[model samples]
Target: MDHDAISIDGGTAADRHARPGAAGAGGANDLLAHFSDPHSVARYAEGPPRFVPGFTDLHRMTRLLLTERAPDDARVLVLGAGGGLELKAFAEAEPHWTFDGVDPAAEMLGLAGRTLGPLAARVRLHQGYIDDAPEGPFDAATCLLTLHFLAPDERRRTAAEIRRRLKPGAPFVAAHSSFPQDDGERALWLSRYAAFAVASGADPDQARTARAAIDTRLNLLSPAHDEAILRDAGFSNVSLFYAAFTWRGWVAYA
Candidate 1:
């Protein structure tokens, strides 16, 4: 669907603040800790529907991004590694590469560790914000479905930090959910998300509250804004690589 072409304006800050209901809130310590139990991996692997198709596209994009590089050991950093789906795939595909998964959610990290097992030895998990993460000069960096959670200023700072840690000409791919301009359309989608959250077993009230909290902190950016931020961070050859509905993806050379 050429998802990268969809550009959203306004609501960047608000979008960061709005939580995608309860499922979104699961990233926080309390909820994520419960969700990340090792035994829960079996249940989660039962093929639940993803909120967007871009979930699978990430592997393709990662391969594309790495295609030009020579077959050498590379250091990769994944910010907000979530459940480690992308990191796992990347690690399997590029055995020569070492990956570090960074996320503030200990539960998510634990789940990823258990899932990766042997491969987990090749991945170092860090719990903290991107800025606070340990020093790095990685060959590449990725932030799948995570950047939207940052405020505008934080986004810029993150871009700069990522760039600082990446080798020259390395790529940084970031994706985040955005809002539509049409108020009715936005409301309708929000309603659908609310229903989806409830169906996923999240508490309705908690879901709504979390969504509101995330909405209050979201800082969505238009394509222009995104490009500008990357450029300001010393990135070149910035390009939007994928998109679907509210999900916008970009790749920038550091």
Candidate 2:
């Protein structure tokens, strides 16, 4: 995805892969390729609200947690920032806050711009992975519904990079597909994930298909390992704050 003059440095695929845990493969990984489609980008806004439990409350919770450490004039770094749902929510909540949003998919970032509308003025969109983001001592950071796409090693490396960009004691919130990896439990959680989607008004087959995709594609880990990833990345005071059918959220400090 190419960036215009106003956009941040969105490096090439090789540049993205130059470092461990680097995302934004210009050549297109499966997830990135999926979002690259105009159809997917157009429908992006619909998926999260319907698939993820308590989507609105999740954004509200993220804002509250960030506000605990971030100042009124906080400069936040948001990874997986495509579509701008969370960014819009945060901007609405804290009018003074400015943002640097990173995403691998240019189409989704464009959608984010459209979604933010006038609020887009406060956000600088970067169409690349974490590596494309500015070297910042940011006030806070967030990566939600995105990390599941990476392997454990990559996730740890990415979290470490996020921590490295934070000010001392800055809050970092991450939420994604996390559940038990135990044999029986893993299958159980996945079924529940699909069931919940259906209950939330999704087509039963569509929900089941989505669940199967997650089961095959996402690198899910047990909650213990998820917390350990934060700790291993040098975050302190890690605490789990949200847990839905197949999702988990944690707030940690750098």
* Highest lDDT model number: 2
Q: Residue 158 of candidate 1: its Cα lDDT? A: 82
Per-candidate TM-score against the hidden true structure: 0.71, 0.92
N/CA/C clash count, model 1: 24
Once fitted onto the true fold, the runs of candidate 2 whose alpha carbons sit more than 4 angstroms away are 1-9, 12-28
Error of 1 at 104 (Å): 0.8
* lDDT scores of the candidates, listed in order: 0.63, 0.86
Candidate 1: minimum summed lDDT over ten consecutive residues — where? 1-10
